[model samples]
Target chain A: MAEDALRILVIDDNRIRASVIEQGLLEAGYSHVTVITDIEALMRCVVEIDPDMIFIDLGNPNRDSLEAAFAVSKAARRPIAMFVDRSDAAAMSAAIDAGVSAYIVDGLRKERVKPILDLAIARFNAFFRLQRELEETRSALAERKIIEKAKGILMQSKGISEQEAYDLLRKQAMRQNRKLAEIAEGLVLAAGLLE
Target chain B: MTGLRHQTQIALGFVPLLDASPLIVAQAKGFALKEGLDLRLLREMSWAALRDRISIGHIDAAHMPAPLPIATTLGLGSLPVELETPIGLATGGNAITVSEELWRHMRDAGAPEVAGDPIACGQALKRVLEACQKQPARPLVFGVVHPFSSHNYELRHWLSAGSIEPDRDVQITILPPPFMVDALEAGRIDGYCVGEPWNSLARKHGSGRIVTTKNRLWPGIIEKVLAMRSGAVDADVTRRLITAITRAAEWCDDVNHREELADLLSQQDYMALPPPCLMPGLTGELMLGDAPPSLEPDFLRFGGSATVPLPSQALWLYAQMLRWQQTSFSPQDAERAAAVYRPNLWCEATGLALPQPFSITTFDDVHFDPGQIQTWLAQYAACVE
Candidate 1:
C-alpha cells in the first residue's frame, strides 16, 4: 500500500490499453510498473520481477494465463494482492466483474490487493459504461435513419404527409405495445418489399 | 406417412474434436430427421464457453468430456448445474505429440527408434528426458488441452510410466488443441498431448511427431459423452435426441460406413478438416512424421460396448480429478457420478441387446469396472502423489 515504489505488472495484448493502464498506475503515484504483451513470458516474469500486484486486461482472457496463475498460486502459495476466500461470493463477483482474474499467494497483506482490485474494477466499469453509451447512440441513430426511410416510402406509396406517417407509426406502436423504434423498423422492412 | 406430429428444433453445441462424432453423425446421416428432431450443430471455441452456454440454456445439449458434467455438477470450475446423460458418443481418440526438436533430442540420447510405435517412442523419449535432467534448468515444457481433460490425465499416465515427475521435472501447461500445432512450430512448447485430428494435423504440418496414442497407452478409454441438462431427461424431445444419436453411433461404428463417416466429420458442419487429413485418424491410423502412417481401426471407436457409458470410466476420471487437485470428491461422490453413466438408457434408445450380466468388476479392454478403476487410480496416486 506504500505510495513509493509499488511494483505492478500490467498484461494486455493491446499496446494502447497497456500504455493506458501503465499511465493510469503511474498517475495514481505507483512506481516500478512493467507492461508485458507476450502471454508466454508471464511465468518467467512472475518469477523474476516478483511484482506486488498483477493486472491482466480482460479483452483477451487467455487460457494460458489463467492456467499459469492457477499453477503459480498452487506452487508458491505466496501472499500477493490477488487471493480472496472462495467463500466470499461478493468479492469473487466483484473481481470477475472487474475483468481481473487473480490469485493471491497466502500471507500477502489484504490491503495490498484491495487498492489494485479497486483500480481494476473502476477501469472495467468505466470501459463497460462507455461501451453501453456508444451502443445506445449507434442504435438511436440507426432507428432515426430507418424512421426517415419509412417516412419517405409512405410519402411515395400512400401519398401521406410526414406528420401523418409519424402518427401512423405511433398508433401502431401503442396498439402493439411495442416501442416507436420497433414500429419504425417494421415500417422500413415493409417498405423494402416494394422493390 | 403417419399423422404429422410437432417436431422440436434444437441447437446442440460441440467442440471440433473427433470424439463429437455421434452428434455430427446424427445430424449428417438424417437420424435426427427420422426421429422428428431438427438438430443444428453449433461449433464452439472452448470447453469453458461450451459449458457456460449449456448452463445458460443457449445450447440444448453438448458432446462434452466425460468428466465435464460431473465436474460442473460438483461446481469444480463454475456454478453447479444438474446434468443428465442418455448415451456416450465416442471413446478413446487422443495422442501425445512432441516437437521436432524434442524428437531430435530423444533420438540423440540413445532413444530407440520405434518408427510409428507410440509406446516405444514414449519409452525412448523418457530415457532422453531423464538424461537431459542432469543439467540444471532443463525443464521440458509440455501442453495439454485442459486441466480437466483426459489428455492431461493420459499425459500424466504416460509420463509416470517413464518415472517422470510431471510437476517437478517438466512444466505442464494448458493450451487449446487448435493452438497446439502453432505453439509447437513456434517452439513455445516442446510437446503436447491432445485429441485428433490435432495430432494428425501436427504430423502433417511437420510441427511435431506422435509420441503415443491413447489407444496404445490405454485402449478403449472413454473420450467424449453426450450430455444434457438434468431437466432435459424429462422432455420428450431429449428422448428423441438420445434415440437419434444412438442410431447414428451404430451407423458410425459400421466399417462399411467409414468413408461416409469421414465425409460427415470433414464437412464444414463438424470438424471442418479436409477428408484426407482427418480420415486416417478417424479410422485409427497412426500418421507419423518419419514413416508411413499405420492402420489402427480401434483408434476412433464408436457405438457397441465402447459407447455404453461405464461406471468404471467415471471412477477413473474421478481419480484423475483428485490426482490433479481439481477436486476432492469422496467415494460417495464417485459412485453418484458413476451412476450418471446411463447404459440402460442407451439400450432403450438403440434397441440393442444390453451386455449380459453387466459386469461392474471386470477390467474389459475398453472399460475398467468400478473396483478395478479405483485400484488403478489408487496405484497412480501412490506413484505420483
Candidate 2:
C-alpha cells in the first residue's frame, strides 16, 4: 500500500496539541488523517475509522481503553503493536519522553511508520515547548504587576518616590537572599492581610 | 552514616488510587527520607503509559497491579521486559460495583442484601443475565482497570463461578479507575471492578452499589506490587526502598493512622479524593449502598504479611491468564512468570519470612497447588475450554 493511503488516527484530549499533530500530518501529505478529541466513543470511533496507525498522547487516560480495543482488534486478526523499536533505543526513549505513543497495524513495514512516528514526536515536543513558554510569559507578566503594586504601596505608605520604593524592594530582596518577586509578593500579601 | 551521605533520587510512578498509599506515605511521612532516598511519585493516567514510562527508563519503579508484571514478562500485550516485583504493595482494596439500576435488577433476581458473599451474588447475577438475554438481548458490560489486572482476573473468576461466561454473557472492557464512576453514571458500563475511592465514590454518587470485594472473593489476595526493572536499580537502593515502603505500609495499616493516612492520600499530589472517600478502604468499614457500614477487617491490608512477594501468588495470576486465554500454557513461561515475584529479594531486603508456597486460599475453597498447577487447573476446563 502507498504511504499516503495509510489512514492515521490521532487521539489527544488537548485540542491544541491534537491540531498541531493533525496539521503536521496533513502538511506532510497524509490525506486520511482523523483527529479525535472526544474519547467517550473511542472504541466505536476506532472501528469506524479503521485507521492503519493510531497516535495517542501518553497522558490520555483513555489510553487504557485503547489498549483493550487493540486487544480485541488483535483477536480479530488485525493486530496493533505499541510503537517500540527495540533496536532504536534512542527514538523509543525520545518518543516516550515527549509523551507520544503510537499503535500500528501489523505487517506495516518499519520504514513506512518511522517518518510518521518522528513527526508525532517532533510535533508533541514543539507543542509542549510552546505551552511552557506561554506559561513562563504569563507568570512574568503577573510578576511585573505584583512588583508594580508593591512599589505603589511603598510609595504611598513611606512618602517616597517610585525609584526609592523600587530600591527598597531590591534591598529587601537582597538582604533576605530571595527573588524580587518573592519580596513583592510578600508585601502584596501583607498589605491585603492588613486591610 | 556513609549511606546517608548520598541520597538516591528515585522517580516512582503510580496511578492515583487508595492502594498507592505506601509509596505516597513512604515519601510523605519521612520513611523514604530516613533511608536516604528522595522518592518522587509521578502519577500516570493509565497503566499502559506507566508501563511504557518504566520500560524506557523514564521512571525508576511503579505501584503496579499483580498480574501486570507477569503479563509483561510473558510478552502478552506489549514488549517483553524483565520487570520484577520485590515487594507486594497492598492486598484487597478492589471491589466489584454495579450500577444502581443493575443492583436493583440483581436484588430482584434474589441476590442477598448483605455484602461479602461472592457465590450468592454470582448466582443472582447469572439469573439476571438469563433474564436480560430474553428481551433486551444485550449483554451486561463491565469495566476493569487493565487486561493484566487482578480486577480483570477476579471479575472473570466471579462471573465464571456464577456460570456466566465473561466476554460472552458479559462484556469485560478496560476503563481507567477515574472514569469508572462517570461511566457508570452515563450508563456506558453496567458495572466495574476497580480499586478504592472509585468504588466508594460510585456508591456515594448513588450511581453504583458494591456487590463483592477482593477480600470477599479471595481473602489476602495480592492486588498491587512494587514493580521495577530486574537489574536496573542498585541492590542497596532497592533494599532501602523495600524497608521504607514496608514501614509506610505498616503505618498505613494501623488503625491510629487511618485518618492521617486518609488526609495524606487526599492531598492534591496523591489520590486527591475527599478523606471520607478513602476512609472505607483504609478502615474496611465499607458503606455498601444503604446498608450499615459492613466491617470486613480484611477488606484492605498493607504491610505485615501483605508485603511478602509470594511466588505461588504469581503462579495463581499466571493461571488466571491461562484460564482466560490471555496466554497459553508453557512450563518455561510459567517459570518465568513465577520468577517475576522475588520473595528471596524481599527477604534479603527486609529480613521478612517468605510465606509458604501453594498457601493461597480463595472464597470458593479451590486449592491451588503451585506444585501441581496442571492437575489443579483441570477443574477449570469446563470454563476455559
Candidate No. with top DockQ: 2
Regions of model 1 farther than 4 Å from truth? A1-61, A64-72, A75-195, B1-5, B109-112, B115-119, B233-235, B255-264, B267-269, B353-369, B372-374, B381-385
lDDT of 2 by residue, A121-188 (tens): 99999999999999999999999999999999999999999999999999999999999999999999
Model 1: per-residue Cα lDDT over B37-119, one tens digit each: 88888786567546545655657888887887777677565556767666778777888889888888777755445544554
Q: What's the TM-score of chain B for every model shown? A: 0.90, 0.97
Task: Locate the minimum summed-lDDT window of 10 residues in model 1 chain B.
Answer: B357-366
User: lDDT by residue for model 1 over A1-195, one digit each (tens)?
Assistant: 465466777777767557766776777778788988887787777777776666765334354335435544545534232322322445545655555544444455666666666776666666667678999999999988888887777787889999998888888899999988888887778767757
Model 2: residues with Cα > 4 Å off, grouped in runs: A74-87, A147-184, B1-3, B383-385
Residue range B171-263, candidate 2, lDDT tens digits: 888888888999899998999999887888888889989998898888887999999987989888999999999999999988999999989
Candidate 2: Cα lDDT at B203? 85
